[model samples]
Target: MVQRLPLDAFFQRETTHPHKRYMVQPQVGGQIEELSWAQVGNQARRAAAWLRAQELEPGSRIAIISKNCAHWIIADLAIWMAGHVSVPLYPNLTAESVRQILEHSESVLAFIGKLDDWPAMSGGVPEGVPTVGLPLRPAGRFDSLWSDLQAFEPISDNPQPAADQLATIIYTSGTTGMPKGVMHTFANFGYTGSQAVELFDVGADDRVLSYLPLCHVAERMFVQMVSIYAGQSIFFAESLDTFVHDIRRARPTVFFGVPRIWGKFQMGVFSKMPPKKLDRLLKIPFLGRVMARKVLAGLGLDAVRYAMSGGAPVPDALVDWYQRLGLEILEVYGMTENCGYSHVGRPGSRKSGWIGQSNPGVDVRISEQGEVQVRSGSVTQGYYKQPQLTAETITEDGFLCTGDKGEQDGDGYLRLTGRIKEIFKTSKGKYVAPAPIENRLAAHSEIEQVCVVGDGLPQPIALCVLSEAGRKELRESLQGSLVELLERINDSLDKHERLRALIVIDDVWAVENGFLTPTLKIKRAVIEGVYGPRFHEWMEYGTLVHWHDEI
Candidate 1:
């Protein structure tokens, strides 16, 4: 099979379906702007012509700093059309951090688009690098604006880059130290996109929301690349305030979210109908079936044929809850190194808690060190300017040593144990993997986020943040619920792995707070740093549940 670049697939789709709507962007006051395949191609062509006029060195790095907007995709396509590599920065990144990436990548140009926190990130672009302001960019000075570029005609010569040519440099969310730029070729995106579309059986009829940070590999491969490959339509969420409206307006045929989102969706259902009342209704014969449809429709997920949960391990209870509601969410597992093409819980052959079978053309084997190593359709070309770290990640034989530890059952389904570096030793010299334990705690529905830590302590303890549902409950009731959850989880764990207490805190964990990565995965080290000093103080309370405020 010929490995096609993203633009190749997109160009073909544009030619075949010129009138098909490709992007639906939400605007102010419940308005929306829809762009067709030909319309998008025309705009990208105009932008590409402007880029070519600059006469930069071939394969020059062109950066895009924006949220998920139609212009973001257009800018990326224009970069590809101009025969340059693309660099995408998370919209939530600090200005200094942005400067670090733009300078390190040596970005020659940047397209500034819709941003919620533009003031915070505007200072990151170095003075020398030319900036092009898109239609939605918060007021800023730029070398050129999207409106000005509109005067240029579409470039006549269509450019198709080679499959092996460098296509993008996606930086890590930096849960640890400085971010590392992950270099990937056009071939990587093409192959991963093709594999995912085939696995999900996605067609032109399918639609998807592009809410997750497009800079992340999972969203890049699944939303942008998959859409181009499958000729699927894309929708952009305006903001947190309009997320529900956006989802309902799109009514996407496919949906993806992290574990936290799935739990929130469950809670969203509960906000309208109490859990007990809904359960009672679901138990009824014909009424139960109608109720399930109503519940899913209300959440704007009634049309979702393929629902996926990833970026973290999901609890069996959470998955089962959705399953009971007739929404079977498949668990997908991958990382930045592989273009997010590792494993997906295939529809018919899924088992509880498993990451599912290895994707087609992907090889998965457990190393002697117990790390889950994978060689797939789209592994990275190594870290840009960080060869030493790249050498440490990819094995001499070829498999990417995915820092995660896992065990495969007899049927070939894989279950993650924890991060290789996350297994912390207690003061008693016992090792504990926090992921599995956190999954159990998060299953209670009230416990929104949890990080299990015990380094230098006799027993492992959990630091938790409450969900919207949890915060609404009466203090005594919430504490009692947590105690019950703690006892149940402890009963199933080994002595060293058992959590000593559930520390409930008032603080919310978000991407801006440094508690979570841009993709919503917890930053374990960051959490440990902020709370490590008080681990002993909280542990001294000697209670199964410790409310930080009341104490």
Candidate 2:
């Protein structure tokens, strides 16, 4: 069965259910604002009219700089309606990073909205590119305003972009070097959006929170494309302070989060009820369900039927913890190249390591050298303007060189071992995969983030960051728990893979600090570069566990 294009499906919603509430936005001063399908269409058409009046060449690249909000989606639709391509930027990027992307994509115009730090980010807009200030933006930022654009008459005719035409160029939040523009066609989103609607069983009644960066592929596909296909209502989060209230008010049925987000949710529960006490109570048959529901309801996740974790590998123990509460966190494995339509865990997939089965159209295989490769309609055309690099990435047979090594079971379940580039040889002539080891170490409630590196060393040592639980505990107590965690993990591994020391650092590995990507994955190369010189000093220390601050 051939599905209609994404815009056509959305137009159906705009014409048929014009009055249906499609976007629920939270405003300042504790007020709520809503835009029905008709309202959304009106604004998008008005913006489209304004864009068309500019007389720019067809398929011009327009950029959007904003946090997740209703206007972000409206601006995207307007870009499409005006027969142009959209380039979405991560809202929290630095000025230099922002300018690099805008100048690289050569965006003709930019729409700004919903930011915490416009003053710092404003200089990134190149001098020649025109800017439109979207609603909910910092005041006096743009030469033109989105609200004023509505004065123009709405476009009378509906415009449909061709199936294979370029729709969006999503930039990669790179773990190394400059970000690459991943060009995707409308057909890419349409196929994934249609498949996602079927996979999630979403409909108009389904509610979702739009809190993750809208520029991200996972959020773009789940929140934006899925909503367009299923006609789901999207709720926007106002800020960090009101997140709990916003989710409670929305009561989303379909929830998606990265591993860090899932960890934060777990920490919220632990903040109220200690994990030890909660674990004991969960074993009590009659009271377990009651406590689970109570905890979930407090976090506004009681109504969540489908909870997805993606972008980074979720720790197996974290998944089990939620499983004990009768909530299964389905781990999804995908990349920006595939538009996030790769593989997913179903309801009954309560396994420890596997990332579940492949999606219907995606063919997953372990290459001869052990890299995980994928081929599907959802894959990107190639990296924009870098044909040589694109040739190096995509195989002759069309599979994307995922750069990940993995093993597959008989039933097609896949377990990622590590990145091919991440597996490093030690001085003792042993190769170690840090991802699995790090996943095991992160199970401890005290260790929020862990990275294992031992290149050209006798044995790999773990660099750790304290979780909230770890931070509140006495320093001596924190040391003992991590020691026990270290010994437990080492007992299950080869002697060569055993960690030499656990070094807890005082610094935060944040995006602002250049240690983490926007999606919260640690940049191993950067981390190693900063700490590699200190490894010998750390390994020769007296104790098995060392706090860097103490030294």
Candidate 3:
């Protein structure tokens, strides 16, 4: 089990299995287009030649803005091959934000591909920056189309980046203020990538589905770096409409999802098989196994050898529900600074809300202030151009301060209490950690998204958006079942942490609306800004499941 670096994997695969299918991309309709390892490598080589032909200085920064696509990855490979740094912007970012990131990153060239918001993106490019569009056409004029570079021969001696050289400058999707770029070197990726393959026993036989925003470290690690490291074939989902079909076609051996996506899968399952029927069926011993298998197969998760959820807390109840179906959703904890490799629950472990033990070669410690800190080979060098902030984040002892408050059990499993900034004191003078309570409330089949806020109030109250099933269930009982659900949740919490009422918000929280980050973590400050003033009013209503219209 030799651990190969990402670039080594690419060249090795290219020479070993030139014609082997490496990537399968969904086209318009049900069709899929496959690319061999050689073809992918060749395209990357040609693109690299084109990039170098521009004569930008070595280590110049380049930008990539696109949805998940094969071409997006090709451009990334090309960027590295050309000895340049890649700056990936979320496809859904506002034009103003895009401009700000590009300007701040000092990117000399940008590649645009597979975008839904072309006009906004096209307008966002800095006026003098050179732009090249991928297969997808840009809204404005570009210096070159991605296809034009295919005819060029690759550079005879493409520089292989050194381990210490900067590989990328990834900008965090800031919930509080301006996003800061996190600088990572090739050594960081090499360390984390090899560690993941070794820890998970990932091999070439494993298959993966790439659907999340690859700009994020999690998706980049599992979908790109891990795939490259293990020589595994990859699949890209076309759009949200075709996600299920794509998953079925890919039949990924390993799947990673945020809590929101997992909740939706639950909702989808319950839609066809009503909860009453599902509960009754599960009561039977042998039939329960058969039914669970069928349900998992129907959802395209039956083939999943490993399933993971991260970026937020997943409720224990939700994990238990999946375990009953014979699929254990392991909880993972990491950040962009750590290359998305930190703590991970072992497969078939107990259903604890804890995120699990530290990875091999990663050290985790709780600071005296109760913040989670780490010292690892995979940790980033520092934030780009933010030395003061970087000094604040990395302690004098050489550990990266995670800014998350957590406690480690005797067994070394870490249970996160809350973010330092997010802990709020109620009027009763008791501090409440909102994440645990909010995670518990979100476990209800009806609630899709939730945020808990009670600053200066008697008790914390929840603002939740209903899932489709939640909406359907709400239509039937009005508020009875929801009230019952809240009672159960409240019973499990400490007196001060109990949610007083669950207010139903009609609107969906999305990245476009600034309620969610691109990676699906809630923008708490943004959520609080819009809903904070009304919190006292909802708390005073003195009822459960307060409907927006009824208020």
Q: Of the candidates shown, which would achieve the greatest lDDT relative to the real structure? A: 2
Model 2 Cα lDDT, one tens digit per residue, 1-551: 56678789889999989999999998767778999999999999999999999999999999999999999999999999999999999988899889999999999999999888888888898998999999888776577898789999999888988999999999999999889999999999999999999987899999999998899999999999999999999999999888999999999999999988889889988988888899999889989889988888998998999999998789888998888877789999999999988999988865678999999889888889999999988999999888998998888898998999998899888899999999999998999999999999888877888899999999999999888767788888777878888899999999999999999988889887899998899999999999888999999998879898897
Clashes of 1: 0
TM-score of every prediction relative to native = 0.98, 0.98, 0.97
TM-score of 3: 0.97
Position 306, candidate 1: lDDT: 96
- Cα lDDT tens digits, model 3, 161-250, are 788899999999889778999999888888888899889988888899999999999999988998888878999998998889889988
- Sorted on lDDT, best first, the list reads 2, 1, 3
Error of 2 at 426 (Å): 1.4
Model 2 — which ten-residue stretch has the worst lDDT? 135-144
